[model samples]
Target: MQVLPKGVRHIPGFLDRTRQEQLVEAIRLVVAEAPLFVPEMPKTGKPMSVRMTNCGSLGWVTDRDRGYRYQAQHPVTGHPWPAMPDVLLEIWNAVSASNKTPEACLVNFYSEEARMGLHQDRDERDLETAVVSISLGDSCLFRVGGNTRGGQTMSFRLESGDVVVLGGEGRLAFHGVDRIYPNTSTLLKHGGRVNLTLRRVNP
Candidate 1:
């Protein structure tokens, strides 16, 4: 088994092609309902490279005025986020090791030139709950490091159908996408990467 940071698990190709296709379709429906919107950096108001949307009861969002927060309505439309897909709930149940279902599913779309800065998912009320992420479409370079900043980090490629779980000691670790490799997979017709992160927002 490939070793990683404590409590961090990477399951490569966890979903088969058929499942990936089904996930893609499910995401399509979610996008149609919620729509992707650009997220801005806290205070700075700098727009993130990737576009984002969400499903489930709460959605993580950031902007110059509000900073990072979870809300029940879409930033753009003011409508509640779409329901969490059953496939995602099943994945979380199988791997999260927690009885509570995730209340937020952040959907991030990265173009060929997009990347994310190293950051921790720390806005949730409960740190005990694990964060589950699923990758689809093109591959990307994922970077992860210790809980503290400027610590030794590692980079690895995350391909389509891969699943990553951040739990226990690794739950607060810093991680992000360095870059996307276009055309690495034929999963998305337009050639981009979609990342789904399921998180429990409240205690």
Candidate 2:
């Protein structure tokens, strides 16, 4: 059996098909308000493979100028991010061990060819709170490593309705997506992947 790092909880099929559909619909409404925009790498300004948006009081955004940070307004639209969906809030309450509610839900849409580089979630002030991640649509190869760079790593397939929580020692672990499996799920009409990442930005 493969062993994940400490404090990393992988709950497979945490969301049922019905709940997944409902969450997708909620995200659609969020997209309608915030609209997905391609994120850029800090300094280099290279566009990331995934298109991203957010809901909740704060949204995670990165650009050539400001880098990764949470803000109240969309970078392009200049409007506050849509409120966090009830389903997402419920999920966070169910999985997250922290008492504080998540203040940001970063929504990332990944195409079949999209991939994410290994990185840590360290922008938020509340590092003690667990990061709740929900996977939808197609499955993907998820890679995770230790807190330090170039450490031992493990890769696993994450399918639709799967939930991953990173807290405790694993909160600062390096993780990313390797590749997305196309047509693996029929949840999204266009055949891609959607990742909802919930985080607490403040103490």
Candidate 3:
């Protein structure tokens, strides 16, 4: 495991595949209640290509007409969002040194061709809080740039069971997955990479 100059952590094989699968199933159950749906972009309310869903106090939503905001219930089910599973919480507390408690888990699924452009995660209420991300399935080229953006960016080839902690100064840094490399792992059920971003929302 190594810490990037930007302060992002790259812990290799942090979660074993078996534990990773269990965590995935637990997260899937929450998603099953809500399922993955594309969020609409704020202001214009355009739908984002990346399907997103959450488990916790609020779920992230976006539509060309609505935009980014956390809602107490699922837009589709009208049911209160589910809690973040135990396995996820264990992992979060373990790595974050028990200093942070996560209330929202945003699961992002990427196919071989799917990719996220450079962006900063500023939707949460507190900048002091940390964002703990777990990666599974195929490997991906994850990139982290300077907080102000438009500078030399560092990238990592993240694979299954990798845990990355984004916090401190890097908490507000611009970052995203460049592209997923296919056939990187046979352990993943189907294909693609699944990123579980666990965050503490309440300030």
| Best of the candidates, TM-score | 2
Query: Distance from true position, residue 179, model 1, in Å?
Result: 1.0
**Which regions in candidate 3 have their CA more than 4 angstroms from the true location?**
1-3
What clash count goes with each model? 0, 0, 9
Comparing 1 and 3 on lDDT, the stronger one? 1
Model 3, range 1-203, lDDT digits (tens) per residue?
A: 54474667778999887898798788678878878877766677665556777887776666666666677888777888888788988989887654767878888888888888898888888667878889988999999877877877878899899998887777887889888999898766788788988887778
TM-scores, all candidates, are 0.98, 0.99, 0.92
- The deviation in Å at residue 84 for candidate 2 is 0.3
TM-score of model number 1: 0.98
Instruction: State the RMSD for candidate 1.
Output: 1.2
Tens-digit per-residue lDDT, 145-200, candidate 1: 88999898888999999999999999999999999999999989999999999999
Off by over 4 Å in 1: 1-3
The count of backbone overlaps in candidate 3 is 9
Residue 141 in candidate 1, Cα distance off native in Å: 0.6
